[model samples]
Target chain A: MTAGIGAAIVILALPAATAALLSVLPSYRLSAAINVASAFVTLLAAVSLLAAAPQPNAYILVDDLNVVFIVLNTFVGFTASVFSATYIAHEIESGRLTPTHLRFYHAMYQFLLLSMNLALIANNIGLMWVAIELATLTTVLMVGLYRTQEAIEAAWKYFILGSVGIALALFGTILVYMAARPVVGEGVQGMLWTSLIAHVPAFDPALLNLAFVFLLLGYGTKVGLAPLHAWLPDAHAEGPTPISAVLSGLLLNVALYAVLRFKLLLDANAFALAPGPLMATLGLISVVFAAFMLYRRRDVKRMFAYSSIEHMGVIVFAFGIGGPLANFAALLHMAMHSLTKSAIFYTVGQVAQVKGTQQIADIRGLTVTHPLLGWSLVFGVFAIVGLPPMGVFMSEFLIVSSTYERAPWLALLLGFGLLVALGALVLRLQGMAFGAPIGSRAPAKASALPIVAHFALVLIAGVYLPPPIVTWFQHVAQLLR
Target chain B: MKGLDFDVAHLLAGGLVLISFMLLYQNRLYALLNVFALQAVVLSLSVAWQAYVQDANHLYVTAAIAFAFKAVIIPLALHRIIAELGIQRDVENVVGVGPTMLAGLALVALSEVVMLRIASEADVLAQEDLAFALSVVLLGMLMMVVRRNAVSMVVGFMSLENGLILAAAGAKGMPLVVEISVAFSVLVALVVIGVFLFRISERFETVDAHALDRFRGDQR
Candidate 1:
């Protein structure tokens, strides 16, 4: 167990450390190759974590919850690095990015991934908050990397909103400490999740209730839940597409993971208020709001960006329902959403580069232009829109059924929003992939391997459940309840 | 909980909330900067008070940061940015001064009632600190919403963060990392704004946010 954790740290640190070394290595290609190598090594470590049984009381353990998340985060992160290696090469060729900025980007990418892994693996709430903020700061800096007017503006907006959200979260953390102080006594012991959970009911109810509110709002913003989600679309639309993939697929899930940890705390406290309804309300609002907003998007990346918000909303809402049926769906949906959204961004990155614009109207008939990328986009959009035989569809169906059994009206709204979003998505997909090919044929030498690999996973997930994954999610869901 | 004694931290935190109201009162851009600087100094003092009261050395680091970064660097940077941007003539407001003050008063009252109700059973100090923190936060947000000038909005945000620093100190023995990050964030933000403001001035004669909209329109 100790060996596994040591390996995890090495996996995370190696890339960042290597990038630091790579920065001074005269050739940019060599540095990019090293970055990709480090990402693969991290992915290897995360995969190996699944085989290593966790030891109790360990600071970092590959448990049921984080095992899936870490693997998913690293896997997507690897693909992103691969794509970025090539993408940055092009930017350097075009004189858009200097070698110095490439070094910064590569280093920050690893740092961001490390922080994400730390957040997902953390055993303590305080540690989790710090890790997530580290992740946020790294991403904020990266988002502003272009140094253009819009890029800076987007980064500034993200920074301000991210800071405010984090401040609210710290207040919630303080409140949690206050609540636990009497029950667990003040000091390091009170901050640990396992310790807090065991003694939760003994903690003050009012403090727990209030703390949960702050926790929900704070982390909910990171999850890109509506009303508090202003910074998200801009961040996604403006940043490099690989970073967009990480932000949408991994970072949002990590934030929700933190919120789930606190929800478990609140759930353990018998007298404390239920977190279910508040989460449900916010989740539904985010879904409906994003769904309607999706139709009017003139910018392609921004359109999918809103779609990320909508899909995350669906996953959180499913979890908020908090039953075996819905929780199971939520977990599966999270996995599929990460894979598909990252894949979509990968495809989008290729398209945007080929056409040199984020404007949807500028790029036309992807299927004729680049069949590999076009089909990937089609499959990605289909998967994201919750079509049949994709794992997302399975999860969304299960969530609807669960809602139907409990609150029929909410199910209707969920269905309504999903359908509206689906309609807009299909419309745009056809517009981009089925129409006449008007753009230049400058073919991309992009790797189709990642897109194919993700589709295969989503495909397998829809048809069958690997027993270990299903069992793991069920256990975590029961813990949530 | 009932037996716990709190004297100076309590008074200082309350004083910080009272000064937050000055945000609504100050109309001139330079005066608003002065008020913000004062608020940061007060925030630093409160953190220092907590360090003495709670016997934690880490919070003293928070105090030094609050004083050094917020009180000095941010205001000085903002002062220069405003001067360079040529928007230092007077502050503009989307809403009138009177209604904004009235809204600010109502916000304070709402904070008191809400905080008192939520924290009714907690120790008196926490209840008071939470109430004051909420007021400062809400007032900061309120200032941002009401003011049209970008500089004032920045002032309002700095004031809000000053409140956050106070709340962190009040929590007592909370990690030094978050406090340090908060201070570092203020510094990072100052650099970004400094750059953005200079660019704004170079692009357009005025730093009025409305001018930014017009700049966009012209580009489009």
Candidate 2:
């Protein structure tokens, strides 16, 4: 028990300590190194949770639901920081960011990691809301780090929309507490997740239904769901690429995890309205909408941002299906998408640095210019587009097959959206990678180790499922249901 | 005592919604700031009243924070920001006041119907307070939508936040931590917006959010 508590404390505290240290460190290289080191240490702590889970307390809890997320969050955070170390150096050399900006960037990176970890572990509903809000504010700061008009605009839009989402969420949370108060009584116990779930069946179903709507819209905005996803593409296009990676890879998952937590509460209540239909509707709309939007994107990062929305839509839809198999598939898809998308961003970062632009029209012939970088982009694109051998393909297959048995029309629609996105991605990839070189042929000074490591894990997961991992996912899926 | 609590909470919450309407029509930046300040003051009074009636001491701290930060400090900060940026004192609304007022009235009606219908079992006092709170929230969102000026948008967001605090206070037994954190988050948002105002004006010589849209060249 002591060891488990210590591990949890280390996981929560190390990133924050790193953030403070990085803020004061004048040397950019040293801060970057420390950022990576801190992330690695946090990852170790998170992995330790698998051995001995902590008891659920008033403030923080570790359950089957969050442990999977904790491990994935820290792992990607560690790799993204490693990718950032090299990626940020190129930005400095190109005079896009000064050392001061890098200091802020490094610090905010760890701060973001810390806030996300806190959000995942928080057992109190209000505490989770506060932590997620902190994550939003930190990302807003980092998004505007460039101080360019476009970057500022993106950051401002994100701020306004994100705050509105958060405020609505707060209202929903208060309503939940009110709903619980009559039965559970007053004080902190009324707002505790464990207590709420335990007593949900007795709570007023109408109030719970109303609260779920607000929570869905509120956190859905952060999750980059369609109709609330306007801030997403611009933020990705304008900010430093590393922040974009973390936003797509980790932040969206955290928000969706919050939604799933609420969904579980609603599902446990026999009287409350089923939350699955609403989730499925929103998810399908996002998938279709993002697929169509992908064709019109002029910036490379913006295209991928839309793709992130589409994949999140699928994951939400699977969880909405709510059977054990679908829930497990959703969990697997979430892990697969995070790994694949971050790896893709790492490659895109290198390509942008080498070619000196983010415009899809300006760059071409990657294969001839830099073979190693080119093939990696090819591999990432293939993997992300759900090629047969990739983990994403495996997860996508599970989702579609499972959905077909229950709702064939929905599955058809999903498959169509996926195909449309596939076409758009392939068309863009061919133009960028196969034609004659049009931009700088200079070699990119990037560490390919992170990308290679991510793709390898993804590849291995696709080919063969380890026994222990499958059992763990099954346990989590049961908890989710 | 029960009747007095219900009437007072209803009146104060209604005042917040009314001030939110006042916020919508104020084309002058200084006037908008003044209206926002008034709204925050009303919010603090309402919260304090809840604290007194519920005998919840922690709510007193929330009331104090609302009075000190939202009512005074934020408006003063925005006043300074406006003066420094030399943002045009009179700003054009994306939609005219007559139409905006009509929309606001419709929103208030919608909230009343929605809240009353959904929260039928709640006590009369809580139900009325929630209805008014929802109106304030909806109106704040309307203000954000119709105003093109960055400063006005910030005011709109703060007003929305005020609505949330009112709701939290009315809900019996909400923890002190939530109230305090909400206050702190709004302050941090103000600081970040203040800095961005200077940055935006420095870059474009205008604080109009439309200028930002023009730069992006695409609209969602």
Candidate 3:
């Protein structure tokens, strides 16, 4: 027990301590190294959690549900840091960032990592809220790092909308406490997830229903759902590419994790309204909305941003279906999407750097100019479009099959959206990788290993799933129901 | 609960909603800040009364934070920001006062109906407080939607957070961690928004958020 607790503490503290130290460091290269090193340590600590899951305490816990998220969060965070080290160097060379800005960026990156980890492990709802808010604030600062007019505007929009969403979420959280107080007795115990879920069936159904509505909208904004997703495209488009990668890959999953926890609480109460239909409806809307939005986007990062929303929609819809098979598919889809999307972003970052523009119109003939990056992007788009022999294909196949068996109409909608998105992505890929060479033909300076590493994992998982991963996901899938 | 305790709590919570309406009606930037300051003062009093009634010492800390930060420091800072930006006299309203007030009234009615129906089993005092808090929250959101000025939007957000604190205190025995974090988030939000307000004005020569939309090329 003590060993497990110690590992959890180290996982939480490593990023925070690194963030503090990096803020004062003068060398950009050293800070980047520290950033990646600390992320690696945190990933190790998270892996250690799988050995001996800790008991649910007041503020933190290591359970089957969160261990999956912790491992994914740390792994991607570590890779993103490695990618950032090279990516930020190119930015400095181009005078897009200074050493001073790099200092703040590195620190904010670690803090963002710390907060996401904390949110994942938090057993107390209030603590989770605080951690997510901290993460939002850090990202807001980083999004505005360029200090350009559009960048500042994007960060401001994200700030106001994100903060408002967070406030609504807090109100919902308080309402949950109010609902639990009568059954669980007040003070700290009422806000603890373990305690609240244990007694949720005895709480007021109406209040719980109302609270879930707020939770859905509040966290839904962070999840980048349609209508609440105004800030998402701009944030992804304007921020540094590495930050965009983390935002799409890790932060969205953490917010979804929060919503899932609350959904479990509501599902426990027999009289409470079914939360599944609402999630499914929102998920369907986001998928369709983002798919159409993809056709009009000119910026590479912005297009991928919409793709993230589309994938999140599908994942949420799968979870909404709420059978063991569907739940398992949803969990697998999340991990696969995170890996693939970040890999795509890594490729996109290099493409932008090589061509010196994020505009698709300005760049062309990646196959002729930078063959390594060009084909990697082609592979990423293939994987993201859910082509056969990709992990996303396997999970998306399960989701569609399950939905078809239950709700044929909804499945049709899901299939149509996915098809539209696939068409759009393929069209863009043709333009980006095969047209007449136009922009700067400079080769990318960053390492391609991270992209290769991610794609390799996705491909392996698609072809074959190791027994342990299958069992772990199955255990969590049952727990979700 | 004693009748006086109930009435006092009712008065303060109701005053918060009323002040939110006043915020919606105000047009000039300076006047909006003043109305928001008044709302904060009412919020502090409501929190203090709950602190005493519930005898939760930590609620007093929350009350002090509200009084010092929301009521005094934030308004003064915003006031300076407005004067410095030379937008003190700007009259910025996206929707007219008459319609906005009617909408706010409708929101209050809606919140009352929703809260009273859903919270039928909760204590009477808490039910009343929750209803008023919901109204204030909805009104604050309405203000954000109707106002064009960035500063006005910040005031709207702060007022919405005040509603949250009110709800937190009314739910007797709500943890102190929540209160402190709420207060701290509000402070950080204020500082960040203040900086953005300056940056926005510097670029556009106006604090109206409409300028921001014009800058976004994707917006049709």
Candidate 4:
């Protein structure tokens, strides 16, 4: 128990301390090292929680459910920081960024990590909302770091839309407090997730229903659900590539985590509308919509951004399907997607840097020019599109098959979306990977370790499921249920 | 005494919803800012009244923050930003007045139907406040949807935040109201700083979103 508390403190404190330190550290190399070191330490702290007991408190909690997220979040955060160090150095060399922006970038990156960690561990719903808000604000500044016209516009759009979503979420949270007040009887108790979930069955079902709708729309915006997803592609396409990787790999998952927590609340209430169908419908729509969107994406990052949406849709749909196997699949899919997508970005970042352009039409024939990166990109595309012998394939297959068993029509529709997305991805992959060599052929100087590391992990997870990890996922899946 | 407390809270909240409507019809940025300020003031009053009736002393802090930050500082700062940008004369109606106002009314009605139906078990005062708050929130969104200028969009966002503050205050004994308000204040401050940094006027040569749209990287 003591160890659990210590891990939680370290998880939250390390990033916070580093954020402050990075802000003042003028030496870019030192700050970059510190960022990676802190992220690594945080990841270690999160891993420690795997052995520690659950520590639920007024402000924080470390249970089977959140420990998985915290570990995954910090692991990706660590790798992204490693990738960021090299990537940003390249940016500085190219004059796209300066030392000063690098300082701010490092600081905001830590703050983003801190906020996401806080959100994952927060026991109080209000605290979780604040943490998510902080995450949004930090990333908004980072998204606009380039100060380019496109970057600024993307940041502004993200800020405005994100604020509206957050405000609605607050209103929903207040309504939740109102609903819980009579039974939970006031102040902190009403807002505590521990208490709220315990008392929710006795609370007003109608209020829970209304709150769920608002919460869905609110956090749904953050999750890049269709119709509320206008800002997402732009933000991803314009931001620094490391931020793009983090956005796809970790931030989207955090928002979906919030939605799942609320869905748990609705699920506990017997009289409330089953939140499943609503999530399923929206999830299905996002899958089909973003799948079609993938074809038209002119920019590589934006194309992957749409793929992130499609993958998120599948995960949400799996969770929405709401059986042990489906939830288990969702959890696995989320982890695999995070690793695979970020690996793709690492390769894409190198590809863009080497080619001196982000436009898909401007660059082609990667395999001829840079064999390592070309092949890595190919591997990433194959992994992400759910090709054989990759982790994503395992999760997607589980989701589709499990969904098929329960609701065949939904399964068919999901299968159709997946196929469409797969087709678009393969089409893009062929053009970018196998065609005649085009554009500048500068060799990439950044380390390929992060990409190789991520893809290897995904590859191993695909081929075999270690029994212990399987048990962990199954345990968390039960908790989610 | 209890009846009077409810009536006073109801009056202030209803007034906030009314100013939200006032915010909706203003084509001029200055008028919209003023109306948003008015709404914030009303929101502060409603929150203070809730503090009094519930005797939740922490709420007073939220009320003060709402008054000082939203009602006074935010508007004055935005006024200076507009004057410096020289877009004070900009008229923004992405959807003209009649249709926008009509849409605003429909949103208010929709909120009333939604809130009242779901909040049946809550006390009458809280229920009514929530309905008014929801209307205010919806109208603010409508304002954002219809405004093309960035300054007006900021005002619209502030008004929407005002609605959230109202809802948070009305949910009697809601914890974290003060912290949430402070968090929001920080958000608004950052947004104000964003406006300054973007130098919306100098960068795009106008604060019009259309200018921003033209440079959308994806299109190229």
Question: Candidate 3, what DockQ?
Answer: 0.52
lDDT of each residue in B92-189, candidate 3, tens digit only = 67788899999999999999999999998889989999999999999989988887777777788889988988999999898854444464555455
TM-score ranking, high to low: 4, 3, 2, 1
Error of 4 at A217 (Å): 0.5
Candidate 3 residue-wise lDDT at A33 = 93
lDDT (Cα atoms) of all candidates against the true structure? 0.80, 0.87, 0.89, 0.90
Candidate 2 vs 4: which has more TM-score: 4
Q: Tens digits of per-residue lDDT for model 3 on A1-481?
A: 8878988998889999999999999999999999989999999999999998778788798899999999999999999999999999989999999999999999999999999999999999988888888888889889989888778878888888898888889889989988998888879999999899889999999999999999999999999999899899989989999999999999999999999999999889999999999999999999999999999877889899999999999999999988999999999999999999999999999999888888877768898889989999999999999998999999999999989999999999999999999999999899999889888877798988899999999999999999999999999999999
Q: Give the per-residue Cα lDDT of candidate 4 at A365.
A: 90
Clashing pairs in 3: none
The value of fnat for model 3 is: 0.48
* Rank ordering of all candidates by lDDT, starting from the highest: 4, 3, 2, 1
TM-score, structure 2 vs. true: 0.97
Clashing pairs in 1: none
Error of 2 at B118 (Å): 1.9
Model 4 scores a TM of: 0.98
Lowest-sum lDDT 10-residue window in model 4 chain B: B200-209
Residue A115, candidate 2: C-alpha displacement in angstroms: 0.3
Better of 2 and 4 by lDDT: 4
DockQ of each: 0.32, 0.46, 0.52, 0.70
TM-score of chain B of each: 0.83, 0.87, 0.87, 0.91
What's the candidate order when arranged by decreasing DockQ? 4, 3, 2, 1
